[model samples]
Target: MRVLVAGATGVIGRQLCPALVAAGHDVVGLARSAPGADAGLAGVRIVVGDALDRSSIQRAVDEAAPDAVVNMLTAIPPEIDPKRLAEQFTLTNRLRTEGTRNLIAAAGGVERMIAQGLAYAYDPHGDGPANEDAPLWRKPPKPFVPVLAALRELEQSTRDAGGLVLRLGHVYGPGTIYAPDGSLLRQVRAGKMPLVSGGAATFSFSHTVDIASAVVAALDSDEAGVLNVVDDEPARMSEWLPFLARLIGAPQPKTAPAFLARLAVGSWGVAFMSQLRGADNTRAKNALDWKPRYASWRAGFATELGGLAAADAS
Candidate 1:
């Protein structure tokens, strides 16, 4: 199979491209910026193109002429400054929404298409282990509105194109927020991150390596629709955050005054800390014949954090 990975230089892309190549798929990666800036994506044929630019995307798609196309682009580590939220969300939204439009148009001939979506966007007013059929948050508080709106657009576009949407869990792995130099880890290390309110928000975490594998599996299948790519167990913020902090040798995060957090991180941070729902991966497991390498956060969290700590300390 010949695969084209857009955002192939992103956190997950850096891992996915190599996995695809190892699986015997010829891979072509789209990059708008400097080539090989990402550590693990060296062998992929790099095509320069910003996913938001229609012409650039078309050219990239034409160059690869892939049998399958995977839309894995995202603008993450978003600006922490509240003033920049709108603009940052809009830009990242384009990668997921408009960028997806361009890719679908460019990949009309491809047999399979796999797109990245968020599992965390579901309405938080529910029980744990929500399935794909659950209702997405319609009135996401202020800052998240643009992001969720874009997510809706992206999903609609992919569904219309008969593409598969991988509504991935909050990704945590080598190149993700749990990485030694990642923003979240730095915040945790510095005691800037905190558990807002009770910290009972359910978190659905997916390892990057597992997500990369799922992307490959999605491409290999003819099944079209949405699947939540997450682990077996969903963790509550209170349970996971402190455990993660302990593993990283960081002081336990202090509980932020909920109102202050709302003012600072905005409603977005509050929702993550107090309200989000965790996704169920039963569909992906049964349909794609896939299971996460780390079924529980407990199994992998310590090892993952320990390695990053060792590297950072060294």
Candidate 2:
């Protein structure tokens, strides 16, 4: 298989490109510059392309002439302010809605097409973790409306193109918010992150290594539609926050009232911390014949972040 990967220099791309190569696929990675920056992607042929530009995307796709196309484009900032998540996600929204259309046009001849999606967008009114078929948030906060709309557009377009949408869980592992030096860890250490309104929202986490493995499996399969690629465990914020703090030797997080929390992280953040729903990965595991290496954040945090914290201290 000749696979063309957009956003090849990103955290997931850096991991996915090499995995595809190791699986005996000829990989062509789209980059913003030639001779891509990541040395980890040794075998992937790099081609400069602008995902948002129609002409540039067509040229790159033609140059690569790949058998499959993977859309991994994103523009998330490192230090996120939950209050401004919708504003912060503006570029990422474009990439999903606009850039996705450009790539789909360029990849018309490709045998397989896959794009990233979010698993956590399901309505919070559900009783348990959401399956892929669950209703998405109908009335998201004003800030999240655009983001949710973009996600819907992205998923619809990909399905129309007969492509698979991997609705991934909250991603962790190296170069991610769960990483030793990432923004989330910094906040946790600084006591800036708190348990908002008892943090009732449930979170389903996926490590980068597991996410890459799932992408590889998706490429090898003929299945199409959406699948939630998450770990086996779904933990609440209240359950995970204190555990993470204790594991990383950080101060116990304080609980903030909903109104007070809103002033800091906005309504969207309050909902995220208190009302968000976790996703069910049963379909993905059954379809892709895959399972995450770290099936629970409890174990993942103990081994990954805990070890890293120990190393940094030593």
Candidate 3:
């Protein structure tokens, strides 16, 4: 299969392109600039194009002539401003909605289209992890409304184009917030992040490597609609945060009142960190015939942080 990947230099794309190549797919990567394109994408043909520009994307797709197109485009900032976190989702929202439409237009002849979706958009309800059929947050908090709306638009457009949507969990790995050098890690080390109350919000995490493999599986899959790409474990923030801090050799996180947390991180952020629902990956695993290498964040975080510790020691 020939695959064209937008946002090919992004955190997930950087891992995915190479994985696709290894899986015997000819890959073309859409990059905005020459330097933005990673030289490490050994066999991937890099096409210079901005996803926001329909003409550029169309030209790149024409040149690539791919059988499938993967929309991995995002514009999330490396460090989110706590007071202005809502602002951070603005450009990414555009990418999810407008950027996705442009990509679909560019991939006119492509038969298979796989898009990125968020597992976090599900309404925080039910007794267990949310599945694909669970309702999206109808009335999401203000900061998350646009983001969720864009995600819904993206998924709807993809499905309308006969594509598959992977509702991925909170991604954490190298180049992501869980990384030793990532923003979240820095906050943990600096004691800036705290658990709100008992931190009961449940989260499903996905390692980048696992997510890349899932993308590869989805590439050839005939499965349509949404599939949650998350780990086997669904843990509460209190369970994961202290564990993560221990793995990274940081002090145990302090607890803040919900009001204090809302004041510090905004209502959306507080809700996201302390009240979001977790997603189940059973459908994806069965449909894609895939299993995550890192089954749980317990093992994943330890190994990832352990690697960093070893590197630093060396």
Candidate 4:
């Protein structure tokens, strides 16, 4: 299959383009500039285009003439301000809605279309992990409502066009926020990121490698619905935070009161780190016949941190 990938130099796309090539698919990556076309995307062809611009996207799609199009476009800032973290995703939200529409529109005659979605948007209702059938938060916290609304629009557009939606969990790996030089790592090292109360909120995590593999699976399969592309283990902040800190040689994070946290990081940050529910990947595993290589963040973190350490030593 011939695949056109938008955001081809992004965290996920950087890894995905190569994976798709290795899996025997003809891949064309869309980049807006020379820097956006990273050297890592050596095997795949690169097309210059802006996903937000309909004309650029159309021209790129026409050039690629792909059988499928994967929308991996995002504009998340590397360093998130605690006070304005909720607003940081405003551009990414736009990418999901407008950028997605542009990609779909440009993907004329394409059979398969896959767009990204977040697993953390489900309402915190039950103790168990939420599945694809679970309801989204109808009334999310004020700051998060726009994010969820944009995600809903992205999913709706893709599904309406008979495309697949991969609702990925909190991604952590070499190029992600959990990496050695990433924002979360910096916060953990500074002791700024903390557990609110007992940190009971659950979070499902996926390694970027696994995320790429899942995309490959989705592209190969005919499954055309929302699939939660997460790992096997579902963990709470209380469990994951201290462990991560220890792994990275950081001081144990201090526990803050919910009110203090709300004042520091805002209500949305508090909810994200303390109240978000985990997602189940059963549907994705069964439907796409896929299983994550790093089944838990424990293994994923060790590999990522170890690699970072090795690189530093070299």
State which candidate has the highest TM-score.
Answer: 2
Candidate lDDT scores, in order, read 0.84, 0.90, 0.88, 0.87
State TM-scores per candidate. Answer: 0.94, 0.97, 0.96, 0.95
Score candidate 2 by TM-score against the native: 0.97
Candidates, ranked, lDDT: 2, 3, 4, 1
Q: Model 4: per-residue lDDT, tens digit, 1-314?
A: 99999888889998898899999999998888754333688788888888888998888889989999998889988877656856798899989999899888888558899988999889997769999999998777788878888999999999988999999999887677887889899899889988996897898998889999999999988899799999999999999999888877778989988898988788787887788899999999999999999999899888888555345346
lDDT of 2 by residue, 89-182 (tens): 9999999999999999998968999999999999998899999989999898888999999999999999999999999888887788888889
Which window of ten consecutive residues has the lowest lDDT sum in model 1? Answer: 77-86
Clashing pairs in 3: none
Candidate 1 structure quality by residue, lDDT tens digits, 100-191: 99889988977888899999889988876789999999678788888888888988998888899999888887767676667788888899
Clash pairs of candidate 2?
none
Query: Which is the winner by TM-score between candidate 1 and candidate 2?
Result: 2
Alpha carbon lDDT at 297, candidate 2: 89
Supply the global lDDT for candidate 2: 0.90
> Where is model 2 more than 4 Å wrong at Cα?
35-39, 312-314
In angstroms, the error of model 2 at 203 is: 0.3
